[model samples]
Target: MALPVAMLGPTVAQAQGWPTAANPDEVFLYPEESEDPVLLYPDDNSSSAPSSTPPLPNSPNIQPTSVRSLQLIGGEVLTEAIAQAFYRTQLGRPADPARLERIAFAIDQWYLDNGYSLSQVSGWMIDAEGVLTVEVVEPEVNQITIRYIDNEGRALDDEGNPIEGRTRERFLRRELQLQSGAVFNQNDVIQDIQSLMALEIFENATVAVDVDEESRETPVVDVVYNLQERLSRSFQASGGVSTELGLFAGVTYRDGNFNGRGESLRFGTQVGSRGLVFSTEFTSPYRDSRPERLGYTIRAFRRTGRSVTFSDEVRLANGDDARERHFGGGGSVMRPIGDWDAELGLNYSRVSIRDDSGDLAPTDELGNDLTLDDSGIDDLLTLEFAVTQDQRVNPSNPNDGSVLTLSTEQSIPVGNGNIVMNRLRADYAEYVPVNLFNTGRRQNPEVVAFNVQAGTVLGDLPPYEAFDLGGGNSVRGYGRGDVGSGRRFFLATAEYRFPVTGPLGAVLFTDFASDLGSGSEVPGDPAGVRDKPGTGLGYGAGLRIGSPLGLIRADFGVNDQGDNQFFFGFGQRF
Candidate 1:
């Protein structure tokens, strides 16, 4: 004797391309295709077609009429809310066999949307107590596998390694959103694909669901991920000029997937007309667990420039020739809390300052003039805390979203009578989308973005740590660092971006900033800082070009100080 085999296939009503209301198949699946099919629903009063005509001598017979009560079997995955929803849609209504099949489809759709790809509603039957018992089979994931595919359909890595089969599996297993033996969910699978593509190591990623049918009664699915790996490591050379730092050139090395894990490491150095800088950074998405992030950064830099000192008036006073050098390293730990993230960090720094101009004299802690030889170094141990909430649709270019960041840092003296200060800062940005022409396409629409940032320091801080506002990333109309380097500052900016063609765009922006303290005050001064510093205003228009490297921005701005400047940079100003 042959065993019975019944499969729920696409409904004939859907095959005829009928709408959900007319076809009825929108909520039902059929065992076979037909030109005219009968609707079905699982209810206590209906007679459902069975997969096999096995003996039903002990089963009770129920009328094909309105169902009074409904029950479910093999519905471990179904929730009480879904059951209530299914029940409300059927209770007190005339029972038709079609309604039962519609219920089955609703259940099947729910499972599919939740990633239970191999689950299905097989059939149903009425029990002796006039209750409907729906038969559902939910198959779980057996294994999740990863494979690397190249343009030529060859299994290879970006480095042309044929051992991609093994290496790819090892590299992806840690990043997999879903693990083996878990119930399949569509959302998790989609998220997995997104996560893979978001990584710099992968150019593209695709997921395919495969089901085993050998055990028709209980199936198992294997999710397969195919990736087009990008270059794991790369080196780039860049040159740029800044109003504050002058012309600079640099080389950087990056490893996106370090140690076969999803960690990233970057090392770079820049040499400019006025400064030299070297830095190294590393980041790990998860530190032994989910929702936790670990990162570390170290930097050494030195810069030489002329700084303006402010009393009743701004001027290049004596000892104006200045050079500042700093060496610092820090590590951070962050964990997610709802839509926000909380982070803590610690750092150590040694700072040295020099005044080459013999005319300028140093100042003591009491604000009294000191001899040039009295200058001393500052050693600091800093602790920092931050809370951030980012719901932006895109980090690189946001069209609709908001981001807020609040941070505080306290730098204590490593030795007695050293400079110590507490600093607090907050930044916020909002992006709103608008359609200029209403062409009916939503992608690449016009965006209005607003940003505001404020910072203040308490106690004594070096000028280098003071709030310095102006330039491409700051108040655009002014030269870099020309606005103010004071104890406290506030800045606000507004920008509008409209599309031109392809990846080309144009932006109009305006910014305003004001400092609240004199720029020349030394640490531990009994006289304290000045209040209500002068405000600076800037406005400009710019062109934006989206390139493979990132967004290129160029702007021509004019400041209230009668200074007109042009700036170029990469990425959004925020």
Candidate 2:
């Protein structure tokens, strides 16, 4: 039994006319083309012609209105209209067919260069009159070839040569010195080539891609890179001045290639009235090839300045000729531990103070004629551990972001009394964007920023041995060494800076400070009563001039006590 036409519609549609259950002659696997004409059912009845006339289905005069003409071309017709229609949805503009075809060819070339040798595009006619469809076929990559030359055009070893594993695809996709995934932008590739050459690692680097025209699948990318080793030594020197510290100069020398092993050595020095200092540093970055660094620092300096004081009363007999000679050396090892940087170091320092007065006397015993050689040397051996988190935009021009530094230090006296000075210090400097009205550039140059610094000395010492907070760098309205003996001090300073054209600038700054004295006295004064606390507020303006030697500055400051002082130095106050 044969199935009804309705039941066989799907199978016949696929097979074009093959039956499901048929006799031997009707059960052919493939059907041959039929010579009979196509038949159509008309909507209206029509009269039949004479005997000489042909059947309605075969008559040329009986044309079917629904039947349309179809044309089959050997190749895909990617017309300009279709190309523009396809790209307009994405690019918001009609694209020329010629340009899109070129882009398609470039994309195909890119795929082939990456080892996709069998990729292709197939087209299908969607409508008999107009529409067309295109489909991309990406085949699995089979093989990739790289044509390259080393610095000497010599065959490279896997271990010794720098360009041994450099390939065209890697250079294009991964190693290119530009951002990737730019949608086959030719300018990006060109810029990458330029950037790579600018590194000075290669004498010449040229890249080009060619595609197989017949298959349009396999592509051959040609890369030529000639490398030249660069010199591995650099030296730099900078000099500047500030009113607090005069005539500062720095020199840095680096040996990029030490022992032909990519080690670096740096040495520098800074000299000024505050201190004539020298420093030497050495670093080995590739100690383990993981960017682990081992470094050592040695610094020596002699600075002349009175002690910072927080007292409201100015002792007339206080020593004005005070100075400090410091010599320190430390070695540190730094490694990346998670997102933070960890450093461990051991330091040794000898601090010597030269003061005329040996010790404090009673109010009645205070005499101007007394001058004692109270100069003594204190030796401190410290073990320090520090962790830092640096998240700054534009580290060179740190106009934004914050940096946190936390450190702990323990001082062990080797020869003197069995006393240890335990110190905890934390510093945070944040750059916050100010409102347009509050910006220094738009206001008077006398405004200063607020700086907060807190630290404690946890050990046995005289009240004078504790932290003091009144000075030029501390409370600007107070005298130097006037504030004394407190484990804690809080200060706020507002500074304003402005430029006056041609390397000339000015700064106006004011600060407030309060002291928390230890309330204990030296061996002589046994009352152990805290010293009188004082508040200081001061403002000053300074002129900055840029020169070859650095910025030369002069500032005149007046405190709340109507004391006017002049300072000559170089560099910014901060």
Candidate 3:
């Protein structure tokens, strides 16, 4: 006799995916890592294991024995009629072990089909009445508790009792929403554990269940949550190169779990030959209180930089004439509505472009005014609303599932740079899992991904705020800001990805974008200073390496114009 579907524990490892630095001009935004799903339980009592032999009646070795009526025992589900139907043909002949195994499998599958994954057949026996009986053990949760873990790993007392953790029990309880008297549903428990990990306080969270022998009660089981907390405060230094920004470096300091309440505070700065940037942000989720209905985030930043453009001969030129400065601060409130995440926010930005030499305007040799209108200071008070749904198996490194995000911004005409504009954008991504060799492969699936992004702006829109479609995170094969910027754009991508080795994966991708014939609307382009073809096509391949810094990516792209480009950065392209 053995235990019913007992899952000893799940192994956790880091993977990648999720939102990253929106601007390719910036260096990096440290990303949140994801964990691999549980592998199949070892040669233990896991019903997920496939059947070892063929179905009954065809078994090569089976010695029949004379027996009375067959019977089924235990579990609240399944009836005599159902049991009889499973072995209706076998009743005409003598009972055999092969037939009994077949009946047990049917009962096991019925339990699983009903969402009772932890319940399964425990044993089989023969009674004095020559009757055969099969026992199905449906375990129920007797109690639940949690233990906090530190850097040295999980701690325990001499008796093996879990040591209390620093995180409050109430916080864990609110996410779990599991009752002691309820039946154990593995799917629900796994999802709750994921939410706990989402708190960002714990490095990993695993579940273990034990037989409650002392209770001597209806197959009672004890559930324990082992939580490993990550360092609350940490510092990271990053460096990267972009054709426009040249060689740039940055430093970041963060408190991921500030004040023991799941608040996050981060500050960062990047300086290079072409620009200097500084940013600070804080996020406070209702982790210790309720759900995300009360969460909010605040951010502020300053970006000042120069431009590289084409001169009179439509020749590449790095000029000091157009120097740009932008200062902005914004805040957003987030709430989880059913399966969708909703956000409302406001942002204020001041932008201005100056001419170091009034005599050095970016003009074509043809004497046309390459300089755009309103190069002076402008102010924008933008109100934004957005909603998103993430259904990926691993949001950071998805193998399957789909994600959709939609947002809009409305500017109010007020400040001296009073600007009036409305913008709408949508991004949709879908992933399909593939396993060319299905029998045995890595736990994570090889995947094919598709993504679409489209946006438009209506009103008095500035070039800086307009959609630019070239960068590591955008269209490849072109340097950041090298591609044209305009009021309307549509971009789509298709990628195939697979693991070449542990922690190292590869992807082949194709990306295409169109300016929707808005080349005329692209400021500073009418004079042929920068080529804006209205349509672009790029294809490339890249490598994804999992490291302490999340996923480090390198890509090489070739545009339709035969131009080649290489990109290096942190996080996934999406």
Candidate 4:
């Protein structure tokens, strides 16, 4: 997905080819495809050759199933004790030519298993008197050099005028695991392949080896990394329904490999019924050459027309639609903790919550009158920490596996901000494969899914800053905030998803949520006036269409009040 902006990627209706939409405030997965430009996310588990050494021939059957006499030749570490330790079974029986080959291969394998990767044993295993002779050659690295093709596919010398590849030679050298003057280890070659692929800049990477015959006393091996580059930059545009923001159109631009370094830059914007929204971001790894890579991203955004109240998808008959406006910039540092990705971020924003019902509600009075008149600005200086673990078979469309996330936000009243609060949110999603259909494409590996969400806020919160629930994004039947935008909330969903046909799926789902009997802490009794129920339940069925742009969804649901509505959205609700 080339999308850098949230809520702006391609939708099913606009599947001309675009990426997925993410939250403007959240860091999104910007996919860099090596194999497929479309209809593909990333094969995170794509594998490479395990070792440089080719497969050794299987040992043939020797008449005695063992070797009665084995002769070992030319090995610095070979000892009578060592031979006995490995050939005990063969020593007690008669031997044959096959047995001799087996013994020679075994010896060769022993050296390799012991970290002597450069050791080689000649195939001349059988000798007179049913004896086995093995010659072990251990080679050392004399020097390591890289071989790369230029943008034009022309090979270049280390100091040649026309350089090879946009990627810096320095970076590749830093990533190669081989070292001069050290024993050549075949395993290092495999590790190097994975390291390069993780950079997401290469379509493919491979290692080649050449042993110098002139340095025969102790042969030296020259190593080379052959890399095929993927397109580094992309432009994307599409239209979609956000469910949260209604119908919208958007555009995004991205550079996955910037300045030949593994840095990324992205910018995007979308305009919808909810309002205009845009985001810009930049990221770079702390050290691209290392295995334990750390990274950071800086971002800025502008948003308007978002409602923290029960803003229905339809235009209000009263011709008055209150909304929130905000602009901010923030940055986060990210680190991988084993299986989890962790991030810590600091953000600053100014928000205006203006409602013409000024006499009815006032700033700090009922969440500060929402600054509707621009009379005051809500200053939000927030610090956040989040950790996520994703084990899905396919992140974009999972048939099995799970994803978990937990986050915390601390907002301090800085520079006249006055509103202070601490918030926590947790989300978990699980997918189980259960092919129930006997036929009819429904068995494209049908899935049973479960999702749970929980959130809480402490301290006084601005009225405009609400954790609203119930809507197309949550409990279906209810409008936004109908279940009470509150200090605490919990929501859960159960779904049975089955494929209908190629790139199309259907789902039956139920959702339940509660405000934990608590309501938004605004000074005014907005909850009472809004008929907030504190809890809601919804049942629905939906269609999912897969596209290069993203997954598009259409849902028809009924809230607890028997209200029915059709909703359109991008991506899975979870």
Maximum-TM-score candidate:
1
Model 2, position 480, has a per-residue lDDT of 60
TM values, all candidates: 0.69, 0.46, 0.68, 0.60
Question: Top lDDT: which candidate number?
Answer: 3
- The worst-scoring run of ten residues by lDDT in candidate 3 lies at 11-20
Candidate 1 has an lDDT of 0.62
lDDT of 3 by residue, 1-574 (tens): 1222234221110011111111232221111111211111243243433332233232334346555676777646556666555555455467655445534554554555455565666666554455656566667778887777654565665578866665667756877855687776666676777688667577557777666645575677777777877556779898898443557998989887676666889899987675667889999874433663578999999865554333113431343445555689999998877888889999998766544332233333344333334335677889999999978765666778999999999998876556788999999999998876452122234888999999999987665576777767777887665555667889999988877776788889998887787756745553124565657788999998866445678999988889979999865677
- Residues 1-574 of candidate 2 have per-residue lDDT tens digits of 1222222223322232311232222211111122211111131122221111112232233222221222222212333443333333223223223323332433233333333333333322223232323344432222223334554454464676644432224433343522321222234345555554433223335443322223545222222323333344667888898432476777767654444443455666666665556656565431222343453333333333343331323333352333344567777777656676677778876555434332322221233111111324556678888887766432222334666777877877664333477767666555544444443331123232344556666774433345555556665545564434455555566665566665576767776665444424232221122243445566788787755344576777777777766667655444
Candidate 3 — which residues are off by over 4 angstroms?
1-140, 147-170, 197-205, 227-233, 237-251, 260-262, 270-277, 286-292, 307-318, 355-375, 437-445, 523-528
TM-score of 2: 0.46
- Candidate 3, lDDT over the whole model: 0.65
**Superior by lDDT: candidate 2 or candidate 3:** 3
The CA lDDT of each predicted structure is: 0.62, 0.43, 0.65, 0.64
| TM-score of candidate 4 on Cα atoms, chains taken together | 0.60
Q: Candidates 2 and 4: which is better by lDDT?
A: 4
Per-candidate total of colliding backbone pairs: 17, 25, 5, 14
